[model samples]
Target: MRADHPLRAIRQLANESLAALQADFSALYSGMGRPLIPPERLLRAMLLQAFYSIRSERQLMERLDFDLLFRWFVGLGVDDPVWDHSTFSKNRDRLIEGDEAARFLSALLPQPRVKRLLSSEHFSVDGTLIEAWASMKSFKPEDGTGPGDPPTPGGRNADADFRSEKRSNETHASTTDPDARLYRKGPGMEAKLAFLSHALMENHSALLIDACGTRVSGHAERVAALAMIEAHADRSRSITLGADRGYDAADFVNERRSMNVRPHIAHNLTRAKGRSAIDGRTTRHAGYAASQRIRKRIEESFGWIKTVAGLERPMVRGVDHVGWGFTFAATAYNLVRLPKLMARVT
Candidate 1:
């Protein structure tokens, strides 16, 4: 394997940061018991799965057994015995419960180089739906009554009738993943069980500085965007926020201004009979146009996370688990981009 492989740089960075989380790992495992598979190694393996689009833990372990590149990225030697897929799954559940993935991303932001590259003034926000693992049949009343039964001996979901049912989050819930809500992005689109993922990306480097996942709802995007932008911005300084027409709300714009942040949200003018929340006062600035141009870059991050990382329909069920996966995927996107940015600086 080449020494200068792109992943080798990621491995070096992972090792440096993993070492710092030693104490956090210690708390997850008792000192007296048989030593568990190292949390750091488990996380590294997960990163490999995200990077290479490995479908499952079993498949990842299988690759680690023989593939030199997979072993190298995961810090396993040629003769090292790979953990059983079930054990890896159990350990991952523990890690997810502890929210390590989100914390790992948090740790990365404070690093000197990453902090320097981050643009504190100009940022963009957007959200996408992460289709849940559940099926339409699983969405039923919280009282245990479902739409209909599936015929046996016809494979899974053979005869379930989910059509002609008016299901809403208020009246129905997914038995498999209660946190997932039935949502559709627009008219004529089929509603599916899904969660909302939001990202706050800086304009200069188009790097994701913050991200979050939430239960799908109409106002969730605007609510999450405001919270993430506020958290990322310096309170003393006025920052500019770029967003899509979905964020063009009077209340959201007013709130951004109250925080001393300029709302450069895209205007949502309707030809029929609606005025935009944003006026020429904000849109007249040249920076507003520049912010609009850079804001679309956030979609690149989303596209990679969904297609490359296979987060379009996560196997895990639950808001926290889904959120952690989204957060880790965002972190992986940054890791891939950071190496290139660092090389340019040198």
Candidate 2:
């Protein structure tokens, strides 16, 4: 492998972060039973999946078996036997139960080099829909009065017609993944069974500071934005939050002011009689205009996440599992960008 390979820098960062969390990983397991795959190796492999866009654990395992660079990055030797793909499926619940993905992400930011690249005063927030693993046909009536299995032989994917049926989240739920909510992105878009994934990005560096997954709802984006900012924002100093027109509401704007955070929200002028929660007082500042321009950079993070990370349609089912994957992907995004950022500062 080349000395300047990107994975080498990523591996150094991952090693440092994982080393800091050694005790945390050890606490998640008991000494009584047979030893399993090390959590550190599993996490490194998961990062590789996000980095390379490998679609499945089976494929990841296959690549690990022969790819020298992958084996080296994962801390596996040439003579080591590759574990079965099912090992990932079996051990995933343990990692989720331990909250390892979120911990790993948190562990990255406090590093001396990374902390300097972060901004203390300006941020942006947004949400994206992660299509659930369940199919539309799995969305069934809550009362169990919906259509039953077809009598035709090999009826696994029998036709499901909703021409005359009225189905909604209140009246129906996906049997395969009950936590997924039926949501539409906007007017004229087809509704899908999905969960909302929100990210909080600091405007100065365009690096994600926090991320989470939630059951889709009308106010999920605004609610998540407030929660993330509250957790990460310094209470002693004022900050600025930039968001699109979707977050321009009286309640949300008021909440930000209550926390001493300036609301750099875009005016939703198309509302009734041109009502807008943001007025000239907040918009008159030169920083507000700069924020609007920088805020769009958050979309680059989302684009890489959905396209390069293969999370546009997550393979996981429940919200917890989905959130775990989302947070881990965010960590990978930072790692991929950090090497270049650090080099410039040096």
Candidate 3:
């Protein structure tokens, strides 16, 4: 593999970190049974899925069986038999249960060159809706149905009519994905069963430092953002957090200040209260202006993850699995960004 090759960079990144990753993987499993697929190989394969936008695990395995670049990156021998797709999924569940994706991101960040590019003090936070795999038909009444109730003629995939029904998270839930919720970004947009994927990104490189998925709700975005921010919040140093008008609530701004952090959140003049949570006092700084300008870069993460990484409508069913996919995608995004960033700096 030549140094200029794209997968070469990722291959190097994974290989260099293999020792640490192995230590982490050991804790997730006890070495007592038959030898299984190496966790590192599984992670590399998962990253390949993100890089190529493969929609399903079966498709990923199919590609790995024939694609030499993928096989090389995944450290698979040419004649190695690909694991069954079902077995691959089962192994992946173990990684998700152990939160390996988050740990992968953590391990990647301490690289000497990458550390210099990160801005710990200035960051932005935002959330986007992840369309759930479940369809509207799956969102049925939560109450027990009478035995006399007729089943839809076509079974689980049967067409459902919700046109006249006033469906809400309170009264109904998705039978296919219980963790997903009916949600809409705004009034005019149609709601879908979805989860909110939130990220805390450094303004310097626009790389995600932390991310998580949560049940969809009006306040879930704000709540998730605070949790992400608080995890990195340090009392010894003040950090500035930039956000859009959606984060302009008085409580959120006040909460940011209470943590000894500055809130550079864009003000919402359209609020019914006729006032903004952020005032000229905080916005007057040049740093605040820069934060507002740079914060929009965070959207690039969402755009790439949704379109390029095949997360537009996640195939997974639960919030935990969906979150695992999102976090891993974020790691993949950073990996893609790092090589280009290093080239420019050199």
| Backbone clash count for every predicted candidate, in the order shown | 0, 0, 0
User: Which regions of candidate 2 are displaced past 4 Å?
Assistant: none
What range of 10 consecutive residues in model 2 has the weakest lDDT sum? Answer: 149-158
lDDT of 1 by residue, 1-346 (tens): 8878889888877777777788888888766755578898899999889898988999988989989988877878889889999999998998988888877887777777777888889999999999999988788888766545745784665565556667789988888888999999888998889999999999988988888899988899999998898776666888999999899988999999889888888878753467888898899999999999899999999999999888999899999989889998998888888889878777
Q: Name the better of 1 and 2 by TM-score.
A: 2
Give the better candidate number (2 or 3) by lDDT: 2
In candidate 1, the residue pairs with backbone N, CA or C atoms under 3 Å apart (3 or more residues apart, or in different chains) clash, namely none
Give the alpha-carbon lDDT of every model: 0.87, 0.91, 0.88
Which candidate tops TM-score?
2
Evaluated at residue 210, the lDDT of candidate 3 is 93
Candidate 2 on 237-292: residue-level lDDT in tens?
A: 88999999999999999999989899999889999999999998899999999889
Candidate 1 — which residues are off by over 4 angstroms? Answer: 32-34, 145-151, 154-156
User: What TM-scores do the predictions have?
Assistant: 0.95, 0.98, 0.95
In candidate 1, position 6 carries an lDDT of 89
RMSD of each: 1.8, 1.1, 1.8
Ranking according to TM-score, highest score first: 2, 3, 1
Candidate 2's error at 217, in angstroms?
Answer: 0.4
